[model samples]
Target: MSLAQGRSYLAIPGPSVVPDAVLRAMHRASPNIYEGELVEMTAGIIPDLRAVARTQHHVAIYMGNGHAAWEAALSNVISAGDHVLVPSTGRFCVGWGEMATGLGAEVELMEFGTKTPMDADAIETRLRADKEHRIKAVLAVHVDTSTSIKNNIAEVRAALDGAGHPALLMVDCIASLGCDRFEMDAWGVDIMVTASQKGLMVTPGLGFVFFNDRADAVRAKMTRVSRYWNWTPRANPEKLFEYFGGTAPTHMLYGLRAALDMIHAEGLEAVWARHETLARAYWAACEAWGQGGPLTLNVADRAHRSHAVTALRLGAPHGTGLRRWTEHQAGMTLGIGLGMSEEGDPNGDGFFRIGHMGHVNAHMVLGTIATMQAGFDALGLPYGAGALDAATKVISGKA
Candidate 1:
C-alpha cells in the first residue's frame, strides 16, 4: 500500500519550503500599487534586507529570479570588452561567468572542480599576475547549490588585498544568504546577488542585488548601462514604480516582509547556528550509513561543505531508485544531483542532494534521515547501523 498520503516535503536546494507566515501574508487581495500600505511596507523592507545581508550598503529589488539579479548587477558596472575573473567551484559560478560573457565581457574561468572549495592562493596568484589590473571584477559564489561547496569569501578578499588588486569582488549568495552566514560589508564584497526563494523562506519571484559605494563608483564610470537592468534607480527610487523598474511584485513584497520579520525574530546568528547543527546531524547520519554501503557525501571535508545543502553519492540506479522510493512511499522528496554528471551516469543518476536550509528544524531533519534509512532497507541496500543514533546525538548536542 502507498503511504505517501500526507504533506510531502520538497527538499530541493532552491525554492525551499516557504514559511506558513509568508504564505498567509501572500494570501491577501492585491493592494494599491501606487500608494498605500504596500508602498510603506516596501520602504521598511529595504533596511531589513540590508540587515539580513549584514550590509549598510544599497540594495535593488528586481521582479525576477536570481539570474535577473546577476544580469542587473553586471549591467551596472560591466561594459563591453571589460575583463572579469571567475573562480568557479561549481555550476552556478560557471553560469555567472557565462552571463558576463553574454554581456560582452572577457571572462577568464579558474576551475576548482566540484568536490572542493576554491583555493584562495590560486586566486591571489592570478590576480598578482594581472599587472595592469585588466580584470575588472572577480565573480565568486559563496555557496554552490549544485556541488554544495562553500567558498571562503573573506579569504578571497584577503587575496585581492595581498595582490593589491583593485578589481571589484562580486559574489553570488543566492543559496547562502540566510541559510549560511554571510557578511557582505565585512567580507569586502563590492556586489552580492541573491533570490528570495531559497534562504529567505519566500517563493521564487523577487531578486536582490546589494552593492556598496565602491561598486557604485565603478558603475558611474561605465559608459552605458541598460535602463531596465540598471540598479541605481531601484536602489534609490523616488516613486514606487522605480523600485522595480515597473509595477511592483506586490504579493512577493508582503511575503518577503513577513519572511524578514521571522528571520529577525529568530536572530540571524541563531538561524546560522541552527543550520550548522542540522547539517552536522545529516552528515553524521550519512557517515554512519556509509560505513557499510555505497552512500557517501560528495564533499568529504566538513569545513568546505555547505551548511544549507548536502550532496550524496549512492551509485547509479540506487540513487534514482532511493529518491523515487522516498517520494512515492514516505511522502518525502530529495534534491537531484545537479551538475554532477559522470562518465556512465550522464544524468547524474548516481547522486542525490538533501536540503536542510530555511524553515527546517531538528525534527524535520531527523525525520528525513530516518525516512532515508528506511528507503535503504526497503531497497535491499546495505547500510551500517546507528545512523539515527548518530543523527540524534548531533541534534541533542551530544556528538
Candidate 2:
C-alpha cells in the first residue's frame, strides 16, 4: 500500500537537497562566536559568495529568509512615500510590492499573470509614462519559482535606461542565483537579493543582498532606515560582530562555506550547463507525457521557462493525485502549483512543479522521470510512450 522510505527527494523549488559535505560541515558543535575561526571564516566566505553571485559589490549577510532580505533591501532604499514599480510574473514579486506598501511606499503593480513572463515592452511603456520619475526602484524576480518563468534582468535594465529612469533595479534571485545564468554587474543589477537554500546547496537561515555604488548612494539619501536592517555596517563592518549584528550563525556559516566551495569546484559555467542539460531532459519527458493527456507546461515557450524549475498543469485533481502517488508510492516529492488560484485559473488544483536545481544529477533526474511514468501507468492515465527514452537520449548526449 505504501513505500515511502529511504532518502526521498525533495523536488520543490527552494530548500533543495543539501549535500552531505554541507551537512557534515554544520554538524560540528558551536564554534567560538566572539573571534578566531568563526570570524576568519566569515571574512573568507563573503567574497566567495560574491563570486557565486557574479557581483563584486557590497554584500550584506542577513540571518533571515528571502522575505527578510526583501525588507532589508526596501528599508535601505525606500522612504515613507517613495514610489516603486513591480513587474510581477508570479505571486512573490507582488508580495514583495506588498511588503513595500507595508513599509509605507506607493506600489505600482504590473501583474503579468501566473503563466507568463514579465514583458519588457510593457515595463518600458510604464516607465516612459512616468514623466516625474517618481518610481525610485523596480523590483523584479529573476526566476519566479511558483510559475517557473524566468524574466530577463537585462531587459528590465534596458527599459529603465531607455526611459532615462534612475530607479534602482532590485532583483529577487531567490530561486535563480547559482542555477540560472545571472550576471549581476554585467546585467546592471543594482540590488540583488537571494537565499542560500536553493542552488547554493545549503540549508536555509541565510539571506544575502548585494548592492552597487548607485544603490549605496540611494541608501545614503534615505532619511529613514532602521538600524537593525541597515546595510552600512553589515557590508563593511570594522568588527566581526557588526557583520551579523551579534553572535553569528555558527553552524550555518560552516554549511555555507562548504556549499560555496562546492560551487567553485564545479566551475560556475559548468554548473549552469549541468542545470540546463537536466532541464532539457525533463522537458523532453514532459512534452512526451503531455501528448496524450490534459498535461501542459504553464509557460508554453521553453525559452521563458526556468531551467531550475518547471511548472505543469493537468485536469482537475490529477496534479494533486500524481503528487500524492509519487510521494507515498515512489518516494518522491514535487512542488505544488503555487499562485495558480487567481481569477480565470479554475484548474488551480491541476498544477504542479518539478525542481531540478542544485544537488541534482542525471541519474536522479532519470529515476524521477521513471517513477513518474510508473505513476501514470499505475493511475491508468494516458501518456505518450518513450518518455524515458526521450529523457535518456537527451541526458546521454544523443538528442
Candidate 3:
C-alpha cells in the first residue's frame, strides 16, 4: 500500500520549498501596479537584494526566470561580435553559451567533464593565449545545477589576474545564490545572475542581475542593446516603470520581501551554515545507501559539491524506478538527473538530484532521506542498512 497522500514534499533542486510566510504575503489581492506600496517595495529591496548577493553592485530586476536573467546580463554587456569563454561543467553553462551564440557572440567553450570542476590551469592557459584579448567575457556558473559541481569563482578571478586578461567575469549564481557562500565584491565577480527560486526561497518568475561598475561601463559603451534589455534605465530609473521593464512583478515583490526577511532574520551566514549542515546530512545518508549498491554520489568530493543540490546515479532502470517510487508511493518529489545522461553518460535515466535548499530544516531533510530508503524497499533494491542512522547522526552533530 502506498502512502503518497497528505502534505507532499518537493525535494527538487530549484523552485525550492516556499515558506508559508512568503505564500501568505503573495496571497494578497492585486496591489496597484503603477504607483503605490508595490513601487516603494520594489525600490526598497535593492540594497537587501545586493546584500544577499554579497555585492554593493547595481541590480536590475527582471520579470522572468533565471533564463531571462541570463539574457539580460548578456544583452547589456556584449555586442554582436563579442567572444565569451564558457567553462562548462554542466548543462546550464552550456545553455548559457548557447544563449550567447543566439545573441551573435562567438563562444569559446572549455569543456570540463560533467563531474569535474572547471580547470583553473586550462583557463589561465587559454586566457594567456588570447594576446589580443579577443574574449570579452568568461561566463561560468557558481554551481552547475545539472551535475552538482561547484566551481571556485575566486580561483577563476585568480586565473584571470594571473593572465592579466581584460575579459569580463560573468558568473551565474542561479542555483547557489542563498544556499552557497558567495562573495561577489570580494571574489571580484563582475556580473552575477540569479532568479527568485532556489536559495532565495521564493516562487519562480523573478530574475535578478547584479553588476559592478565595470559591467556598467561595458553597458554604457555598447550601442546595440535592445531598449527593453538595457540596464541604464533599469538601474537608474526615473520612475517605477524603469525599475521593472513595464508593470512590476507585484506578487513576486511581496514574496521576495518575505523570503528576504526570513533570510536576513536568520542571517545570511547562518543560512549558509544551515544549508551546509543539512546538505552534509543528506550526503551521509546517500553515501551509506550507496554501499554495495548501484547508487553513487555523482560528485565524490565534498569540497566540490553544492550545498543546495546533490546529484546521484543508479544503474539503468533503478534510478528512474527510485524517483518514481519516492514520488508516487512516498509523497516526496526528487529532481530528475538533468544533463547527466545521454551525452554525459550512456544511460540517461540513471541520474537524479535532491534539492535541499532554502527553508529546509533537519526534519524535512531527514524525512526525505527516510522516504528514499522506503523507496528502495518498495523497489526491492538492496541498499546498505543504517542509512537513516547515519543521516540522523549528521543532523544531531554526532557524525
Q: What's the C-alpha lDDT at position 142 in model 1?
A: 96
What C-alpha lDDT do the candidate models reach, one value each? 0.94, 0.90, 0.91
lDDT of 2 by residue, 1-399 (tens): 677788798888878999999999999989878778998999999899889889889999999999999999999999989999999898788889999999999999998988788899899999999999899999999999888999989999999999988889999999998898999999999999999889988888998899999999999988878988999999999888798877688898999999889999999999999999999999999999888877788888888989899988866677888898999997999888887763555657778889999999999999899988888888888888778999999999999
How big is the positional error of residue 398 in model 3, measured in Å on the Cα after superposition?
A: 1.5
Off by over 4 Å in 2: 342-347
Weakest lDDT window of 10 consecutive positions for candidate 3: 339-348
Candidate 1 lDDT for residue 358: 88
Which consecutive 10 residues in model 2 have the weakest lDDT in total? 340-349
Cα error of candidate 1 at position 4, Å: 0.7
All-Cα superposition RMSD per candidate: 0.8, 1.3, 1.3
TM-score of each: 0.99, 0.98, 0.98
User: TM-score of the candidate numbered 2?
Assistant: 0.98
Off by over 4 Å in 3: 342-347
Q: What TM-score, to 2 decimals, does candidate 3 have?
A: 0.98
lDDT of 1 at 263: 94
